[model samples]
Target: MRIFVLFVLALSFFGCSTKVPCNCKCPKCPKDESKVFVYNEPEITVYKEPQQLSKAQVYYKKQVSYVRKKAAPYWGEKAQVADKFNYVKYAKDFKARTIINFQNGVIRVETTDTANPLRTLKEVIASTLLNTQNPETVDLFSSRHTIHVGEPFLFNRVKDHDGEPIRWVWRANRYAQHLIDTGLKKDAIKTSTGVKKRYYVTFKMKQDNYSNSSELNYASIVKKQAKRFGLEPALIFALIETESHFNQFATSAIPAYGLMQVVPHSAGRDAWEFLTQRPGQPTRNYLFDARNNIEMGSAYVHILFNRYLSDVKNPENRELCVIAAYNTGSGNVLRSFHKNKDIAVSKINRLSPDALYKHLRQKLPYKETRDYIKKVTSAKKHYL
Candidate 1:
C-alpha cells in the first residue's frame, strides 16, 4: 500500500512538472539547454503615402493655360478670349472652388458646393455658345475648354421685377427674349410672368413653344403610376433623362427603344408578353410605343426598389439603391453593399451609379449622381 501511494505521488509530481503546449503554436526550441521559445510579431502591410494635389497644382495650371489658349477663337491677328471666367467670379465670392479639368479628351468639372456643378457648367456653356453669333465655333471652343480645364461654370440669373406684383408686358417679353437667346427655354425658367401673350419658338428648325410639354403632359400619368408603385417623379425623371433625354422615339446602341429605354429581355418574358398584348398594336412594334415603354420601365424600377428595400432601411436610401441597381445589376449593388456596409448608407447607396458612370465626360460619377439627385429633388420640390 505504501509503495502504491508513493507511485501515485510520483505520478502527480510528474504530471505537475511536465510542460504543456500552449493554445497557440510555439517555435521549436533549439538543441542547446539555454534556448527559450520566442514568438515573432505578425507581418504588417505598409501602404505608400498618397500623392498630394499641391505638388501637381503648378503643372495643372500650366496645362489649363495652354488649353485656354487653344480654345480661344482665332481671327486674323489674335484669338479672342473672354475677359472674365464666369465660374471663377462665382468661386471667388462663393464657398467652393469650381475646377474645370480637361484631360484625355474629356471635359469634367468639379466643385465642392452642394449645387450640381456639372449641370451648372453645361448650362453656362450652352448659354454662352447660344449667345455667340458663331455658335458652332463657340461650341467647339467651349467643349475643348471644358475638357482641358476640368472646371465648371457658375450659373447666375438677374431678376428684373421692379417691386410690383404685376410687371410690364413689354418687360416680360424682353425677359423671355433674353431667356431664349441665352438658351434658357420656357421649361427651364421658374419665375411667373404676368403676361398672357403666347410666343413662337424653334429648336433644330422644329417649332415648339414648350419643349417639355410632353413630359409635363405625362406628369399626371407618371404621378398616378409612381404613386401606385410607391415611386417618386424624380426617379422617373432621372430614368427618363438617362434613357431617352425625354425623346419618346429615342433608340439606344443596344436597340432599347422609346422614352424609358426598355430592352425586351431586361423587361422579362412576362412583361414583354403583357406589353405586346395591348390592343391596336402590332406584336413586334411594342418597343416603339411610348406608353408601353414607360410602363415597363416604371415596373422594372419598382421591382428593383422592392428588392433593395430589404437591405436598406431608409426610404431615400432605398430609392438610391434602386437607382444604382438600375445602372449596375442587382448583384453588383448587393456586392457593393457587402463591401461598404460600414460606410454611410448614402454613400453605399450611390456606389453602383457612381461606378457605372465614373468615366462619363460631362458626368463625373459622384458629382453627376449628386447633381441628378439634386435636380430631381428640386423638380419635385417645385412641380410635385
Candidate 2:
C-alpha cells in the first residue's frame, strides 16, 4: 500500500512538473492546427491598354472636342468622355458628325460642311437603326417636321412648332413611315431643326413607362451576381446607379470603365485576380460588358467586406467602411479614423456601427467619398 501510495504521488509529481503543452489557445502559443490569419494579397501592377484607338474612337474624340468648344451640347454634365455605348461617328467624307448620349438617350447630328445635309442626316439615322442597341420603348424628343420613324406615345409640345408646307409635312411623315419599315421603331424622332438648311437634329431617348426603367432592366443580372458573391442585390443596384446611372458603357476620368466604373489598375486588378487566381488587366471592351463589370465590381465589394475590412466587428460598420472604401480604398477608410491600421481596426471594433458611420462621414479624406457613402446608403433603400 505504501509503495502504491508512493507511486501515485510520484505520478502526481510527474504530472505537475512535466511541462504539459499549452491548450489555452492564446496568441503566443498557438496550436499546430490553429489557423493563422494571413492576408493573401495579390501583387498589383500598372494596367495599360494597347496604345491604339479604333477608327470609331478616333473620330469620337475629335468630334467631342469640337462640340465642347462650339455647340455646348448637353451630354449629361457628368460625362467627361464619350462612353462605349454612346456613339459618335464622324464621316470625314461628308464632314458631318453624329453623336449619341446613351446616358441621357439624346442623339445629335451636325455638319460644318455637307452638300446634301438631308442625305447625311438620313445616313446617320440609318446607322443608328442598324448598329445602336435600341431600348424596349424610348420616348423620342424632337421637333414636329422631322422624320418620325417609331410609333409616338407621348409628344412634347414644340415651342415654335413650325414645319414646311402641308405637302412637305405629308412627305416627311411618309418618309418617316418608310424609316419605320426599314426597322427603326424602338427609338423614334423629334427634329429640332429643318431637314433642309444646314441641318441640325437633336433627339432625346426619354423614359415613358416602367418597361424602360433602368432598375428593372438590370435587375436580373444584379440579382444573379449579388447571389454569386454573397452580396445584397440592393447594394449592387445602388452602386450601379451611383457609379454609372445604369449606363453600362460608363467611363470616368480615372479611366474606370463600365456600369460600376471599376478602375482597372486597382479594384479591377484585385477583383480579377481574386476571381481567376491570375494576373491580367481587363480590357475596356471586357469591362464594358454588363456581366463582366458587375461580376468584377461585386468581387471587389466582397474583398472589401470579407478581406480588407473584415477586422471591423459590426456588419453595418463594415459596410460603411466598404462604401467609403469602394470610392476611396480600404487604407483610406482606416486612415479616416487612425493612420495606423491596427489602431484604426481596434477603434472601429470598439465603436457602435452608427458611431463609426458618423466618424466616417465627418472624417473621410475626400468630400466625394463622404458624399458617395451618403448617396449609396440612401440609394440602397430604393433597391431594398
Q: Which is the leading candidate under TM-score?
A: 2
Which stretches of model 1 miss by more than 4 angstroms?
1-211, 268-284, 339-383
Which residue pairs collide in model 2, if any? 105-205, 142-190, 143-190, 143-191
Scored by lDDT, the top model is 2
Write candidate 2's Cα lDDT for 253-363 as tens digits: 455677898867557776776677566657766786677888889888876676567678788888888988788766657766775567889999999978887888889
* lDDT of each residue in 263-339, candidate 1, tens digit only: 44333322443334332222213544455666767766665554223345556556655655454333333333343
Per-model CA lDDT versus the true structure: 0.35, 0.55
Cα misplacement distance, residue 187 of candidate 1 (Å): 32
lDDT of 2: 0.55
How many angstroms is residue 64 displaced in model 2 relative to the true structure, after the best TM-score fit? 8.2
Q: Give the TM-score of candidate 1.
A: 0.36
The ten-residue window of minimal lDDT in model 2 covers 1-10
Candidate 2 residue 357 Cα shift, in angstroms, is 2.7
